[model samples]
Target: MSTEIIYQTLAILLGFAGLIWSADRFVASSASIAKNLGMSTMTIGLTIVSLGTSAPEVLVALSASLSDSGSLAMGNALGSNVANIALVLAITAIVAPIPIAKQLFKMEAPFLVGVTALLGLFIFNGELSRLEGLILLLLIPVFLWLVSRTQTGVEQEEIERSEGFKTFAWFIVSLAILIGSANTLVWGAKGVALTLGVSELLIGLTIVAVGTSLPELAASVASALKGHHDIALGNIIGSNIFNIIAVASIPGVVGPLAIDPDILSRDYYVMAGLTALLVIACALTLKRRGSKLGRSFGVVMLSSFCAYYYFLV
Candidate 1:
C-alpha cells in the first residue's frame, strides 16, 4: 500500500480504538456513580447515563468547532444523531430487539424533533451567530431542569446520591477520558481525511460519526441484552435528543458555523424523515404489543441507513 493509504488505515484504526476505550470508560464511570448515588434505573437511563454516553460526541463537536472545522463539527453532531437511530439502534435490535419507551415518545422524542427542526431553521441564515449559540447553550440547562421536574420520588433519591465525593470523582474521570479520547479521534480523523483525499464532512458523517456514537451503541446493546426495554429505548431516544440540541448547539456557540444550505435542505430533511420513521416504528411496535424490536424493523432501519450511505458516496 501507498504511504497515504497506510496513514489512512492507521488513523481509522486508532480513531475506532480511542472511541471504544472512551465508551467503556464512560459506561463504567457512569454506572459506578449512579450506583453510589442510589439513582433509580429509569433516572439513570434518562439523564446521567445518557449524558455519559453522549460525552464523546459532545467533546468531538466542541474540539472540531474550536479547530475551525465548522462543517465537520456540525456534520458530526447531525450525522451522529442519524447514525444513533438508524445504525446504532438497528444493530442493537439485531443483537436483541429493544422495546420502545412510551414516556420517551410522549416527551423527549418531540423535543428532539423540535430541536432538529430549529437547528435547520437557524442555519438557514447561513451561519449560526454567537447570539444564536448563546441561546442554544442556555437551552441545555433549561432542558435538564425540565427533565428533573418530571422525575418521580424514586428518581429524586437517585439524583441526591449523585452529589457526593465519589460521584464527583467518577464525573471527573469520565470527563478526562472524554476529552482525551476526543482529541485522539479528532487528530486521527484529520490525518485520515488528508491522506484519503476525502472531505472532513464525509469523515465526520461516516468514521467520526460512528466513533463518537460507540457509547450509545454499547449502552443500547447492553440494555437490550439485559432485556431492559425501557432503558434500551430511553438511552437511544435521550442520546438522539442530546446529539441534536446539546451537541449541535455547542458548535453554534463556540463559533459561528456556516451550514451548507444544501445540507440543510437535503440532508436535514432526510434526518427528519429518519426520526419520523423511528417514531412510527415505535408506535407500530407498541400497538403490536411487541416489546422487542423485531428483525423486520431492524432490517428496514439498516437498509435505510445503507441507502443514505450510498447517497453520500
Candidate 2:
C-alpha cells in the first residue's frame, strides 16, 4: 500500500466516524426541537428527523455535481438507497425487527413508492436535466403536504425541551461537521478509487455510498433499539425519498449531466426492487393483527446486500 493510499484510508475511516456522530447529534437535536415545538412523533419522524438524517446525502450530491463528477453524484444518490435498505434496514431488522407505524404504513409508505416511481421516470432516459431537477424539487413540498395530512388524528406532545438553546447550538455545530466530513469522505473516496484504478462511479457505488449512508444506519438502528418505531421505520422511508428527489436534483441544478447507463440497467433496478420489497413487507406485515419485521426478512435483505458487494468486488 502506498503512503497516499494509507492517508486516504485513514481519512475515509475518520470521515465515516465523523459523519455518523454528527448525523446522530443532528437528528437528536432536531427531534427534540420538533417535539418541543408541538409536533407528534409521526410528524417529527417523517419531516424533521428524516430530512435531518439525509442532510449528508444532499450536501454530498451538490458537492460532487458541482465538481463535474455526475457519475459520482449518481452513484452516491442511487447507491445510498441500496445501502439504506439492504444494509441499514436489514441490520436493524435483524437486531430488532421494526414494527411498522400505523400512520407511516398508510401514508409515508405509499408516498415513498410514488416518489421512487417519479424519480425512476426522470432518469429513464439516463440523463437528468435542469428542468427535470426543477420538477423534482417542486415535488418535495407536495410530498410534505401529503405527509402533513397523515398526522391528522395524531396528537402533538408539548415538551419543555430543557436546554433548548444548547440543543440548537449543538445542532448548528453538528451540521457544520456533517458538511466538512462529507467533503473529506468524497475526496478520499475519489482519491482511493483513482489509486485503485477504478472509476469514480464505482467508488461512489460502494465506498463513498456506504460512507455517506452511515448517518441513516446510525439513526435507524438507534431509533429501533430505543423502540421509537415510527422514527426508526420513517427514517429509512424518508431518507430514501430525500435521496431520490432532493439528492437527484442537485446535479441538475448545479450542472445537468447524463447518468451512467449501468445505473439505468443495473443500479436503478436494484434500488427500485429493494424498495418494492420493503413496500411488500409492510403490506404483508401491516395487514396482520400486529406487524413485525422478522429476522428471516433481515437475513434475506442482508444476503442480497452481501451478494451485491461480492458482485461488485
Candidate 3:
C-alpha cells in the first residue's frame, strides 16, 4: 500500500482505540457518580451510561456532516442503530442472555419505534432541513427532563452517587477524545473508501459505523456478564433512541443535509423492520429469566445484519 494508505490505517486504529478508552473512562465516571449518589443501577444505565456510550456516534456523525459527506453522516447514524440492535445486542444475547422488562416492552421499545418512524418521515422528502434539525435537538432536552422527572428516588440516588468533580473531569476528557477520535475516524474512513474505490456510504455503513459502535458493544457485554440483563437491554434501546434523535439530528441542525430519497424508501424501512423484529424478540423472551437467547434468534439477527451489509456494499 501507499504512505497515505498506511497513515489512514494508523489513524483508523488510533481512532478505534481512543473510542474504547473514552467509553471506559466515561462508564467508570458515571458508575462512580451513581454509586456516590446512591442511584439505582438501572437509572444509571438508562441515563448517564447511555449518553456516555452514545457519545462516539454523535461525534462521528457530527464530524462527517461538517466534512460535507452527508451520505456518510446519515449512513453512520442509521447504520449504527441497525448494528446496535442486530450486532451488539445479538452478540450480547449470545454471550449471556438478557431478560426483558415489561416496562421496556410498553414504553421504551415503543418510543424507539416512534423515533425511528419520525426519522423516516423527516427524511422522506430527500433532505433534512435546519428547521427539522432544531426540532430534533429540542427533543433532547425534553427527553432529559422527562427522564429526570420520572426516574425513581433510587435512580436519583444512583445518579447522585455518580456525580462529583472527578466525574465532571472524566466527562470533559471523554468529550475531547470523542471529538478527536471522530475526526480521525472520518478522515481514515474517507481515505480507505477512496483507496478501495468504494463509496463513502459503504465505508460509513460498515467501518465507521461499526468502529463508533464499539462502545455499545462494550457496555452491553459488561452488563450481560454482570447478570444485569435489564441494563444490557436498556443500553441498546437508549442508544438507538439517541442515535436517531440526537446524533442524526445534529447534521441537519448545523446545516441542511441532502440525502438520497432511497435511504427513506429502502434503508430506513429496513431499519424499522429490524427494530420491530427486536421488539418481538424481546417480548418473546420476557418470561424467561437468565435464559440463553436461543441460537435461532442469534442466527436471525446476524443474518439480518449480513443482508444489510450486502445491500449497502
Candidate 4:
C-alpha cells in the first residue's frame, strides 16, 4: 500500500474506535441527565436513548455533507439501515432469539413504514430538495410527540444534583469527541475511496456504513443476550428510522443531493425487503402471544445478509 493509504487506514481505525467509545459515553451521560430530570424510563429509551444511539450516523452525515460528499452521506444513511437489520439484528437474533412485544411493534412499525415511504417519495425524483429535507426534519417532533404518549409505568428515581451536573459535563465532552471523530472518519473514508478508485457512495455504503453501525451491532447483541429482547429490536427500528429521516436529510438541507441509481435499485430495495421480513418475522411471533424469533429465523436472516453481501461484491 502507498504511504497515503497506510495513513488513511490508520485514521479509519482510530476514528472508528473513538467514534464507538465516545458515542457510548455520550449516550450514557445523556440518559443519566434525562433520568435526573425526572424522565420516565420508556420516554428516555424512546427519545433520548434512541437519538443518542443514532448520533454517530447523524454526525457522520453532517461531516460528509460539509465536506461536499453528499452522496456519501446519503449512502451512509441508506446503507446503515440495511446493515442495522441485515447484519446487526441478524447477529443479535442468533445470539438469543428476540421476543417481539406486540404493543411496541404495533406502535413503532407503522411509523417506520410511514417514514420509509416518505423517503421513497422524496427520492423517486432522483434528488432531495431543501424543502423535502425540512419536511423530514419537521416529522421529528411528531415522532417525539407519539413517543411521549406511550409512557411506561416505571417510576423515576431521584439523583443528586451534583451527579446530574457531572453527567452533563461528560455529555458535552463526549459530544465534542463525537464530532471530531466523525470528521476524521469521513476524511479517511474519502481518502480510501479515492485510492481504491471507487465511488464515495461505495465507500460510504460498505466501509463507513458498517463501521458506524458497530455500536448498534454491539448493543443489539448485548440486549438480546441479557433477555431485553424488546430493547434489541427497538434499537434497530429506532436507528433505522433516524437514518431515513434525520441522517438522510442532512444532505438535502446542506445542498441538493442527487440520488445514486444503485441506491434506489439495490440498497434501498434490500433495506425495504429486510424490513418487511422483520415485520413478518415479528408478526408471526405475535400470533403466539409475543413468542420468540427462533434460531431458524435467525439463520435465515444471516443467510440473507450473506447473500446480500455476496451480491454486492
Worst 10 residues of 4 by lDDT: 153-162
Supply every candidate's count of residue pairs whose N, Cα or C atoms clash at under 3 angstroms: 1, 0, 14, 0
lDDT of each: 0.70, 0.79, 0.75, 0.75
Give candidate 1's TM-score. Answer: 0.83
As a TM-score, model 4 comes out at 0.82
Model 4 C-alpha lDDT per residue in residues 229-313, reported as the tens digit of each score: 5556767887888888899999999988898899888887787888888887888888897478877887887788778778776
TM-score of 3: 0.84
List runs of model 2 lying over 4 Å from the truth.
19-24, 155-161
Ranking by lDDT: 2, 4, 3, 1
What would the per-residue lDDT of candidate 3 be over residues 178-228, giving only the tens digit for each residue?
557756876787778777787777777778778767777776776676555
User: Mind giving the per-residue lDDT tens digits that candidate 1 earns over 122-231?
Assistant: 88878887777677667677667766655444432122234467656755675566545555655666666667688878887877777777667766776566555455
Worst 10 residues of 3 by lDDT: 154-163
lDDT of 1 at 43: 55
Best by TM-score: 2
RMSD of 4: 3.6
True-vs-predicted CA distance for residue 66, candidate 2, Å = 1.8
Better of 1 and 4 by lDDT: 4
